[model samples]
Target: MNNKLKLSNEHTLARVLEIKHYTKALFSFKTTRPNNFKFKPGEFVMIGLIIKGEFIFRAYSICSSTWDNVLEFYSIKVPNGPFTSFLQKITTDSSIIIKTKSTGTLVLNALTLGKRLFLLCTGTGIAPFISIISEPGTYIKYNEVILVLTCRYSQELQYFNYKVKQMLKQPYIKLYARNKLRLYLSTTKGSYPYSGRITWLIKSGMLIADLKAYNFNRMDKFMICGSQQMILDVVNLLRSIGYLEGAINNPQDFVYERAFVS
Candidate 1:
């Protein structure tokens, strides 16, 4: 009998290191990164498990920094989801398939020069921003880094709240991230202190007023990720205000990635 793990040329096996369940429907996991795996901070890669000799994969944005030894991902558990149903059952003893290639429009190279960098996201959309802010270069590139995260419930905001605190305490980027990095959280449901969708906040000028910053201008760069509807709304709003969508080959004022909404 042969008990060797077999993967395609584009995939590799990675060992699960840790898993944390934030809520019944939301969880995060860490895995040992392959030495050869290379990716930008805001990129995502396909990950999955081999079930019954069939590979089932899903695109998950990486939540860890490029310099980190391990790779982390934030995920939402869809009831009976083809890949997530089995992923939620994984343990530290299990191994998952990781595709080596990573790609996304949220990378730093996609944006032109800007003074303030705004990372707008909702729910698990916060995943890529985690990696983006964790990179030391992010602070150096912009004078201010603002992260606006919105969720349906306050409980969904806990993970990022904790992560932001930790980033402020990390020695390597502590000084750079101290006052430069700011976090704004909101909940669409419940009576949370800040309650509203990000689109509403921006449209009403409350987002800038709350931050006590200047109004949206060409000097500001935006990276937006979230549900399809949220992305569309934000993109439309930005476009109306003269913000151009950026790409790898064409750097512009803003970039957006449609996160895995399921």
Candidate 2:
């Protein structure tokens, strides 16, 4: 990936069609999709700002499912981030630049078939998991799709609940039933049910205790997304437990990526 971000010639001043605030720092936006544009849900897109004759670009996960015509993204308002500081202020129909290309390793193609799949995340990292859960293949291919989400409080969980309810009602996802999709929220700071950092939850045997119905064997695949340190910590723990990383070209026991920071 390029370290120094620059606007691509293909960038456009697209209009924002809608926005939904999920939390003080978290928000979701929907924009008019460029003509003939196509992308998988888990992919990340480069969004840029063309203001005051200078361009700034940042990567963001495409939160909406592929079947949707418009592009959607869930983002965090980084207090003083060059991009997010302004990106969060976008109102309906405001013009913003978006790159044509979408890329990332979080897509379903990165992992192999497993009896159970764990889509692990924290904070805004839950963006991609929303896409994975809504995809038709998720229910068709995996016996159990458990989304283990970690956040500071339960408010973040509400957005997920809304999305899950919407997904379960869809004709394609109706087959999911209750067993196919399970949610495990680990709230770290707040006094929520299952309170602690996700890393501790897993290492302390608390995670397993929370999901008493099943035991994690090598047969389970894990897809993790979070901060760089969080990814490294989770992957290291998985390795200690015999879980291997997978890829689109070379499948394994797990797959992960650095979450998009503002």
lDDT of each: 0.89, 0.80
Q: Residue-wise lDDT of candidate 1 within 1-262, one digit each (tens)?
A: 1245457789888999999999889999999998778899899999988776677788899999898899999989999888889999999999888998898778999999999999999999999999999989999999999999999999998788877787768899787788898888899999887878998999888888888988887899999998888988899999999999999899999998754433
TM-score of each: 0.95, 0.91
Candidate 2: stretches off by over 4 Å? 1-9, 258-262
Question: How many clashes show up per model?
Answer: 0, 0
lDDT of 2 by residue, 14-133 (tens): 689988898888888889888767777577888887554577788887778778778878888989987888899999858678888778888777777788888889888888888778
Give the per-residue Cα lDDT of candidate 1 at 33: 98
What does candidate 1 score on TM?
A: 0.95
Instruction: Kindly report which residue stretches of model 1 are placed more than 4 angstroms away from their true locations once superposed.
Output: 1-6, 258-262
Worst 10 residues of 2 by lDDT: 1-10
